[model samples]
Target: MALMRMAVAAVVLLDLGIRSTDLEAHYTNLGVLPLHVLFERAWNPYEFSIHNMSGLWQVQALLFLAAAGFAVGLLLGWRTRLMTVLSWVMLVSLQNRNPMIAQGGDDLLRMLLFWGIFLPWGRVWSKDAEGQPAPASYTHFSAATVAYVVQIALVYVCTAFLKNAPEWTTEGTAIYYALSLDQVLMPGGRLLYPHFELMRWLTHLTYYTELLLPVLLFIPVGTAFFRTVFVVVLFSFHIGISLTLFVGLFFVINFASLMGLLPAPVLNWLERKLGPATQRCAGYLGGLRQRLPAWQLPLQVQATWRPRARKPGYALLPMLRETVLYVLVGYTIWWNLDGIIAPKYTMSEPLRWFGYQFRTDQHWGMFAPAVFKDDGWYIIEGNAANGRLYDLYRNGRPVSYEKPYSVMALHKNDRWRKYSENYLFVDNSWMRPYYCNYMLRLWHLNPRNPPLKRLDVVYMKEVSLPNYQVSEPKREVLCSCEY
Candidate 1:
């Protein structure tokens, strides 16, 4: 649990740092969704966000910095419970503020933080460890234990079940299609794309692994072995995915979640192997804990740090805790199941109400059943006041190539790439206006550029795949907007 906490917190910090570069563009009112409109349309009374309190970009930057602090506090186990809550709030708020960029990784990170709040993640390798009683040899059975295991398993199982598309199961071309797409593909994808047959076989292996491996989590016998195997296999899977896709933090977050599933025996063996070094590290951390200011010291101190023995808590404490745990566990199960059998097994209104209130509602059908077939690039044409046409994106360059050189680095993050995907279809007319205006705004903001009177959204589609042959670009005007 401690290792999991540290890993998750580390990922949180890394994610925040990456996002900090585009804090204003991604998290402020000036981004995709303005704060006032979002508050009106999607705000829940139960949810609170500091990110929404101001429209100033500086405020968002401050909030981002504060979130980074909370993540560090979580990693160090300083005021751990409070830090966990704060970290979860900031994560949810930032993601909700501009949901356009959020992906499966963000969802997984949020859920892990939610569940981490209920576990004793600060029990070891933390500054709080200096003033505490020792724990039992094995982790005891509790609602939290069950919930954590079940939640992880549910994500894998739900995804496996939702992959009913023939591309994944029958044709075994899911990975081929995934890699061939220009948007999410990394340079590694270009190198690997030619091996279509290997990708097909790997696709089948991925499906079965996702489907069957989760079952091993529930087996009581050889729990350590099963969990160890699960962690290694899933970690490797995520690493491979990371190598080929520009999926922002998704792979990292999933790798962190695997740390939580590692059994106690494995941790114990690790501790034994690292014995003297572990003690030295703990002592170093203890010394640092002592140097903390008076105000901060209390946060790192254990709940029972006094010299005198304290009376046990009232009988109702355990009962109350158990009640809350069971309630949350039941809701977690229903929430995941509903997502798996969506449209067929919808959650009851009350369940949904609670889910929205907690911001815990989730779906796990990642790249399920079918991968997108349409591969295209956006061509933004600007008609300047000087009666000259310009490619607003590439500084007046013509859109001749099937793939943009910038596609390799065009998207700020995966969310941008995913958002671009929505504009590919003719039915997604909603994107045209926003995209057109966005292009116009960019052109107008550039002092060196000529003023544009109008902008047009054009798409050039790639009709051939599985073979790298280029077809004549099928160009179509998606929409045009006056600047």
Candidate 2:
């Protein structure tokens, strides 16, 4: 639990820091959607957000900074419950502020944090734990624990089932297409793209692993061995992906979730290694306890003196807790089932109403059924006050100068990279506003430097396997902004 909390806190901090760089553009009233409409149209009724209270960029920035501080508090296990709740609220708020930039990884992180709010993850290896008695090593179980394991398993199992395409099964070309795509690929992909046979074998292995690994997790025999293998293989796979693709926090978030499943034996080994350090830390806290007023210390420190005595009321409390867990479990199960089951079981309106309320509404499709074949990049054009046509993208050059694999370099970060990919799809209506936003951004950057005119969505279609031949670039005017 401690490891999971630390990993989650780290990822949240990184995500917030990344978004902080573009606060005005991504998080405030000045942003493309603005804060007011985002609250009414994008935010779920159940979500708690300071962003909804104000549209001012400064207010958003302050909230972002506060969220970052909360993440740090979560990492250190200080005021764990409060920190967890604040982190979840900020995550949901920030994502809703700019839904266009969110991807599957963001959804997964949000759900994990929501579940985390109900878990005793900060009981050990945290500042909260530090102030406890002589030793902090402890263990307990809750319904939330069971739900967490199931949630991670469901992610992999559903993804495996959804990958029922010829590209993944017969041809083993999914990885080939994935690595070849200019949008997400890193330099490592360029080096890996030439090895067709190797990539094909890897594709098959990837599918089989995702399909079978979750099953092994449930096997009672040699549970330790199974978890060790799962942790090793999945961590390696995510690391390889990170090296080959700019997937934002996807790998880190998923990898951190796996820490929750680390076998007790492994955790025991870790505990043994850190035992001495913990003892010294605990002793220091013990000394502090001697000097300070008992009430002045944090609650965790105070708890040692007045540990709750078991009472008859505890029996009723457990029943109440389990009842709430049952409701959450049912909702979560139905949530996943509706997305994948045939004929699609629809939850009642009252239940479906909770979709955004808890921010657990999810779609688990991750490169499923089929890998994309048509991969490309965008080329924005501008007509300057000098009456010259500039690429707007390629340092004021003609569109021909646009590099084939420049998408990785062009985007500010992984969020924009995924946004670009989504913008190219025919179904994404948000592209118009995004394009308009881009023109406005350009105007702000320089009032007359190649004054903005129009933007184009040009796709430099990539070559697929067996044929491995590039096609001519295709261009379409997606949106235009005057003045």
Candidate 3:
């Protein structure tokens, strides 16, 4: 649990760091999707974002800094419960600020924080522990524990059911389709792309693994062995995914989730193996800890010390936790089922308001049904005031129609990649002109740069054909903007 806390806090910090680079444009009203536009077209009535309270990038910076501080408190387990709630609140608010940048990994991360709020994960290896030794046994059972286990399992089970396509099942060509896209293909995927038989086998393996691995966690007998097996297999599975795809934070969050379920025996073995190294690092961190002041939250909750009879309401806390856990777990399962089941079985839009309100709404449909066929690259065509053409996507370079060396590198990060994908859809056509203008504004930020007369967001569209066939990319201008 301590390890999971540290891992989650670290990932939250990393997420904030990556997102801070795009602070103004992505989170503020001055950027592409202005607050007015978001409220008009995308915002939900129940959703709350402190980020929307101000349009200034300076305000966003302050929020980012505050979130980082809470995350650091979470990492150290200082006032663990309060820190967990604060961190989760900050994360949910940031995610609510922009929906376009979100993906399945973000959903999993938020859920981890949510479940962490209900667990006693700070009893050991935390500042709150104050040098108390590690727990004799690392296992515990509670309503929160059951809720967490179910949450992780539901991710894979729902995704697998959603992928009821022939390519994923008997046809066994899903990996081929996934790797065919030059935009997301990594070196490992490219190396394995040529082997049709291997890809077919991997496709089958992936489907079954997602479908079956979670079942191992629920077996009542030999729980330790079953959990060990699940962790080892899923760890390797995510490693393969990281090597073959550019799924930012997806594997990291999964690794953190799995860390919580590791049995005490396996943890003991690892502790013995790495004790010396851990001690050395600990000494270094200990020295740093002394140099730094202790973290204190701005507001602290005061407990009543008056000598009063134990109240019945106080005694109901455990039952309350259990009731809340079961209710939430059931709701989450229903939410996942609604996404995977037939339309008639799904919940109505009004019924799903709670999920969106709390940001528990998730879609794990990654490469589902069938792999995406429309794979392509973008070209930010800019016409300079000097009558020269520059590819602003390449930072105002000489216009070149040739394909980039790595299409994946064209995206600054996973959020940008997600936004780009959304930009391609006709449903999101309202976003294109704003994005074109954003690129134009970005390119002219430097006074010495050549001014742009106009900008065009062009996509070199190529549809991946099965059986090793390739189609020529057709130039499609998605948006054209002039100053």
Worst 10 residues of 1 by lDDT: 293-302
Ranking by TM-score: 3, 2, 1
TM-score of each: 0.86, 0.87, 0.93
Model 1 Cα displacement at 233 (Å)?
0.6
Candidate 2, residues 1-483, lDDT tens digits: the string is: 778999999999999888888777666666656766565545566656667677788888889888999999999889999999989988887787677788888888998898899888876667776645522323446788867877887788778888889988889989888886777888888889899899999999989988888877878799778878888889998998898888888999999888887876787677678656755766788765443321121222223334568898778987888788868877887887774676647676677767767688877778888877667666666665666666655665766735564577878888877767766667665556655665557555874465555444445554444446666655566667665
Q: After superposition, how far is residue 184 of candidate 3 from its true place, in Å?
A: 0.7
The top-ranked prediction according to TM-score is: 3
Instruction: Give one clash count per candidate, in the order shown.
Output: 1, 0, 0
lDDT per residue as tens, model 1, 39-110: 765567666677888878899988998999999999999888899999999998887776555677787889
User: Once model 1 is optimally superposed onto the true structure by TM-score, how far is the C-alpha of residue 224 displaced, in angstroms?
Assistant: 1.1
Number of the top-ranking candidate, with lDDT as the measure:
3
Output the worst ten-in-a-row residue range by lDDT, candidate 3.
292-301
